[model samples]
Target: MHQEPDFLHNLHQELRDGRRWLDRSIVLAYAAAAGLCVVAFTLMADAGFELFQRIYRWQGGWAVLLWLPAITVAAVWATRRWAPGAAGSGIPQVMVTLDPAVSEHQRSRFVSLWLSFSKMALASAGFAAGLSIGREGPSVQVAAGVMHSARRWLGPHSGISSHALLVAGGAAGIAAAFNAPLAGVVFAIEELSRKLESRSSGLIIAAIVLAGLMGVSAFGNLSYFGRIRVPSLTWNALLPGLCVALASGVLGGLFAKVMAASLTSPAERMNRWRARFPLRFAAGGALVIAVIGLVTGGATFGAGSEAVKHMLAGEADVPSFYVTLKFVATWLSAWVGVPGGIFAPSLSIGAGVGHNVATLTGSDSIAPALIAMGMAAFLAAVTQAPLTAFIIVMEMVDGHAMVLSLMASAMLASLISRMLARPLYETLAHHMASALPGPASTQDPPEPAHAPGVPQQK
Candidate 1:
């Protein structure tokens, strides 16, 4: 071989190094955009809580009841008209869109700038309307949309999809939404991608950091839930922890089963109602929530955050049927084709379960631990990512001391959840994946809905 001079080798090395730096710069740009989007999303979600509060303060029960139908109808109409994939906890949409197997049009439909904006607007509307939903799940899809759209803006073929930007966006979204970067990292590994791409490690971390900063800047350093005093684990930790875990897990699993079933079987009543009358079906859900709210003194409305916090503070008791009501509310929100999430609703529900266990078992000695365990287990059951679940609960309440108890509870819950049904988000993702349109246009054609009587459109 002819001798290659050092100068030529040096020039080649320089070009390679320059490309790497350029790639990183591009990622930084993506992170900046994603972080800003999360900031906007946080504000939008806050607007929802504010709206609910304002309405509640102004007119109380009647106002919320009146707002529900209108918001649901508008949210559904706008989402279907402009962004069908925006419906439900946006996590499933992000999950399906992240799949390399998805087409360009489908990806845009599920995770795009338009979808991100639509998710924020509609989800916020749902919250303000007193729907039992959370903003965190929607934030995942919204962040994915922001990053993906930024990639498209970077260039027609900026290779955004070819890289791990979607993965990074999802992880960053969780970090921003929850203010828990470690949980976000764990969520990415255990839930979103379920595998790490060595090339994208730096990209993922940078995105998470930037987004988390945006959150901190906007909200200040607030805990999702204040620190709790978990009793020092005596040999007594096992029994109550187990009780909470098993109960939370089983209940969570059952909730998932009902939801999945409601959308799956054409012969099922939910299918019949949704197929022939989509709008009516959503109205029915709204009605159920409203009635529940009325019966529960409006406890069933919103994301149930206040109630959960109250319980954790030991300042107020969870209502007797709160777990059951919260489940129904969450289930109804999922059933309706609306932009919302069950994460907070699920946590509140888990809190209710734990409180009930402590009360029923009369285990006041370790009540707080049981409650912590319930939150971990229930979240695990819904998400089917025990480590992520427990980590999130641990972070929310600053309950690091209860890690072992939470871990055991979370794992047990997830295992039981696995046995009862498909993971909630994954099953929802399956539905969303099928609904993705082919790559014929930037906008997707009408989705292929699984609702029994609803006809698919081209």
Candidate 2:
């Protein structure tokens, strides 16, 4: 009898351990799935942009005039009708889910699989229409949704909570989207979770690694903007860095402020008009973008990545007005309530600003360094997340030599941005939380499947 009881206990213990490993394995599997999704989305976005370029080359201005408005209407309408949570850059949506005030029900809706599907499909549609948007931001939500879906498969004894899944998914998204694993980890700490829990550290890093591995497998070992060769920066480059930081800070701050105002403040006339007739408003915004594109010879169109790459390669000289028009185009693209992101567009605008600063300073010799700084500074100012911005820019161009400069520019620009507006993602997350149907709750939300685990703080 004693031997039988011991044998049963041993078997039970082994089975329990097996179950735990299996549950953890599910998390890893889902993370890899999220990475695959991001890689696919990247391919889809590039294909969509190629299609738009073909149309633009054939009919030029005429094609854009009719094409942009029609696609804008379709994207906006589809988002509103099907997946309302898939609107905007999607970063705010993921951020809102992290708020403690939001109920599990609300959080689930925000990051559902349907929303992820719609986000990718509709965002790709916007790309085809030549919208000035990026995929990195939306990738966060998409990956989060994919990861969150794993909650259904996890057992009650599973150690990883739903919150951890969401955070891991988001980090994985960034890692895969940009092929920047460290930047993704920084983004999770600085922007997504606001604090990296000891318990979640391994999971987050693993997710980023898996996601990055997926990207590397598909694209090979290439940086997002390719390796930009930068020489040693002497004291002379500092002045240009400062100037680029100032311009990016002001412009990025204003962009963030206006975007938040449009979302949270219904009193704004444009918001009111948009609320009444969203289609008309989107069409109007499309018209404005079309006119800007026509005047800029299509430089202001798309996400502005190709233009930035060409500039970095010394193959193209963008018009001096590129920054102003691209900024307006990006702003309008966001305001029109499409499923898109400002991340790439913000980088593009920053590149333009840096180029102009280089031109003005006659620092043609160090233009590449300044361009990289501008990209980091403007992104930092817009998002108000200096570390993430710096690391992202550093990784994108393999700017290991310019680490100190990139960090300083990002920090200064973020500080300057604070004077003009609140943190862009935080402000938008608050608005999104407030717009949810139920009153804010003070009590902690029950975990998915009612299993207890550490919850992320807002």
C-alpha RMSD by candidate, in order: 6.6, 6.0
Local distance difference test, each candidate = 0.77, 0.86
Residue 248 in model 1: lDDT: 89
With a 3 Å backbone cut-off (N, CA, C), the pairs that clash in candidate 1 are: none
**Per-prediction TM-score to the true structure, in the order listed:** 0.88, 0.92
Q: What is the lDDT, from 0 to 100, of the residue 434 in candidate 2?
A: 72
Q: After superposition, how far is residue 160 of candidate 2 from its true place, in Å?
A: 0.9
> Residue 132's C-alpha lDDT in candidate 1?
89
Q: Which runs in model 1 stand beyond 4 Å of their true positions?
A: 1-16, 153-163, 436-458
Per-residue lDDT, model 2, residue 325, is 94
lDDT score, candidate 2: 0.86
What is candidate 1's lDDT per residue for 182-206, written digit by digit as tens?
Answer: 8888877777776667766756777
Candidate 2 wrongly placed segments (more than 4 Å): 1-16, 441-458
- lDDT for 418 (candidate 2): 80
lDDT tens string, model 2, 17-135? 97777877888898898999999999999999888888788854678898889998999999999998999998888888876677889997689888888889999999998889999
